[model samples]
Target: MDWNDRFAASGPGEPGPPSVLVGREDLVPTTGRALDVACGRGTVAVWLAQRGLVVDALDAAPAGLALGRAAADAAAVTVHWIEADLDEGLPVTGGYDVVVCQRFRDPALYPALAGVLAPGGLLVVTVLSVVGDAGGRFRAEPGELRGAFADLDVLVDEEGGGEAHLVARLD
Candidate 1:
């Protein structure tokens, strides 16, 4: 995915935080380094920065990165926006205190996501699901989130309303 193309195509004021992540403060770390995979306009990334975590926000879109940089600057926090093709996999070099992957589904990257968490780090993810909607290849099935993150200390695992969310802490 060319992030620049997507950003160029966007017609909006600014992107807001993903709805699924709202009211989920417990799933985020209050300090330490964080990573936002496939960070599209950076709403979540900026939110994390506001929460006091230094963030490395990755996206394929240049325009989105620009928005994220602006948001970080306005928030008086630092966020490193890296333009990356998620298809090549997450470019996360250092383990993070918190890792957030929202609205981007890739079963192949599941293990990689789990691998990048520090021992006590948090992993919060939301992906399209087939729970209440017609089944599709990209949608997660019932128990997918729990089954995938079974080793973690799961705080919440909800699969319904066409979405699956998992908030877990690495042990």
Candidate 2:
């Protein structure tokens, strides 16, 4: 199903920390700007706002953004939700303290992710992998994340069970 239709059929659930940050929330700074690209339902956006960061979350689906808005409201935090097509490139500009891209893969945008990081900024990403599952067109091959962001100081890099997660910091 298309993203809009899928989100339209779903509810705005509670916002949770991004998967890569589940037990490593300390890596996040309490101040400064954050961006959640492909922020489906705005879960990471609301979660970042709750942590006291100015957050901007973007996705192509209006229905997903609407659900994200509801989730943000329920969390009592403000998030600048933007409906934008990532295929057109990032809608916002400037460096950010945190940049998160979860469950989305776009090798073409990898450098842009690093380019928008402020000094000491953190980048968290999770994507489907070919490591331990049937490979698909959308899955990253071995060493893709680490290789893609080799310039950054990698804090965490792991791949298994058809998933890859990476957490890196800009020096």
Candidate 3:
């Protein structure tokens, strides 16, 4: 089944902040633009809008975008939701104060993430990884995120329990 089918079959709770930024929301700027790549169900995107950032959320599934739009309306926030596949390249333009890509791993787009960051912008990314688990084609390798985004000042870098997450800021 496609992502749209998967999301249609699922019933998830309300959108929330990126899991990587749960306790460290201070890393997010309150008044600048934000982008969420592969923004499934618009969870993190809507949450960013609630935090006072203008948000752009992109996903491959229209069902997921609809879910996000509902959550945004429920929260009385605005988010620009776009349905597009990231394999083609990032569909948005200009710099953003924050960029978030959770549970999506695309090495080819790593540089674009940094390129889209405004000065001092924060980047939060989480992907399945080889660390502490049997590896899969979709998982990141050890130090993959750090090496891809070495230009950024690393704030949080962790790999374990089948996941890798990085939180960094542009210098």
Candidate 4:
């Protein structure tokens, strides 16, 4: 189904922060410009905003953006909701202290994601992977994240159970 229809069909709920970042708050700077790529329903965006970061949440689906807006309002936080197709490329460029792309995999955009970060900025990414599971067209091969982000100072790189996650900082 299309993202707009899929998001519209989903019910409202507090989706909260990304699992990789839940208890690792100290790894991220509390105050800085942050971007949440493919930020469905704005869960992480609002969470980051509440933590004092100026957050920009991007998603292609208007329905998702609407739900995210409502959720942010209910949480008493503010986030800039951007509507753009990520396949075309990142809509904004540079100066972001934190860039998060969770549960969204697009190898073509990996460079853009890294480029958007400021020096010393942090990058958090999670994607489906083939490790310990049946390989699929959508899943990353083993060591994909590690190799793709090798230029950065990797703080966390893990792959197992059909998932791959990376947290790195640019020098």
Candidate 5:
């Protein structure tokens, strides 16, 4: 999917915030650096900023980053927005206290995702799943999230109803 186009097509939603990766707050650090991968419109990034974490958010879409910047300004928080394609892989520096990737699936980047975490950092991810629906290429198979992030201490893991969510802490 071309996230850039999707974001370009979206009009800004209500000024209020929404979390792309719902729940899993207990796993997130109250204060520290955070990263939001595929951060369309910067909802999660701005939210983390409001939670007092310095944030670095990345997406291939410039339009999305622009909206994210507006949201961060409205929230009176600062977030660094990077425009880049994830297919090239996650940016190589700056470890994060929290890393979030929601509703964007690219299994090829799983290892890089895990490596981006700082020690004791939290990883929250959600993706389309095939557990409760007919299988498809984009839908994660049952246990896929668990296996992909097996190195972490999975705080919450769920797969069903064509969705998968995982919250884990890096060792």
Candidate 6:
């Protein structure tokens, strides 16, 4: 099913905050621009806004973006919500102090993701992985994120329980 249909079926509910950012709060800058790619329901984007960052949240599903807009409004934070398909490549370019892509895997976008970061910017990413689980078409193989983001100074890299997480900073 398409994302719009999937989100429509799921109905209304916040997805809560990003656990990756929660665990590594110290790594996140209090001010500057941030982008949350494939930002469903805007949890991470709103959270970043609350932390004093100007945030841009992108998602292809209108239903999801609507839910995200409501969530952002409820939180009394402002987020620029962009509806764009990542398969077409990143809609915006460069100068983000933080870029987050959680639970979304598109290896093709890795270079663009890295390119958007300002110097010393933080990147937080998490995705389904083959580690400790059966491999699937959507899952990343072991060390996939590390290999893809090797140019960054990786601070955290952990994989298990069918998921992989990475927090890195660009030089």
lDDT of each prediction vs. the true structure? Answer: 0.83, 0.92, 0.90, 0.90, 0.82, 0.90
lDDT of 5 by residue, 1-171 (tens): 465677768855433222423443555667989898988888888888888898899988888898888888887889999988899998857478988898889999998888989999888888999988888888898899999999899988888778898888898
Candidate 3 clash pair list: none
**Candidate scoring better on TM-score of 4 and 6:** 4
What digit string (tens of lDDT, one per residue) describes model 4 on residues 1-171?
A: 988888889955584667777788888888889999999878888888988899999999899899999988888888999999998999997999999998899999999999999999999999999998899999999999989999999998988999999999999
Backbone clash tally (model 6): 0
TM-score of each: 0.88, 0.97, 0.97, 0.95, 0.89, 0.94
Residue pairs whose backbone atoms clash in candidate 2 = none
Lowest-sum lDDT 10-residue window in model 6: 12-21
Off by over 4 Å in 4: none
Decreasing TM-score order of the candidates? 2, 3, 4, 6, 5, 1
Model 4 CA lDDT for position 59: 95
lDDT of 2 by residue, 11-59 (tens): 6767789877888899999999999999988888999999999999999
- The prediction achieving the highest lDDT against the true structure is 2
In candidate 3 the C-alpha lDDT for residue 44 amounts to 89
Give the better candidate number (3 or 5) by lDDT.
3
Model 3: per-residue Cα lDDT over 92-125, one tens digit each: 8768999999998989999898999999999999
Candidate achieving higher lDDT, 1 or 5: 1
Error of 3 at 118 (Å): 0.4
lDDT tens readout by residue for model 1, 91-165: 877579988898888888888899999999888889999999889888999998889889999988888899998
TM-score between candidate 1 and the true structure: 0.88
Consecutive 10-residue window with the lowest summed lDDT within model 5: 13-22
Candidate 5 colliding pairs? none
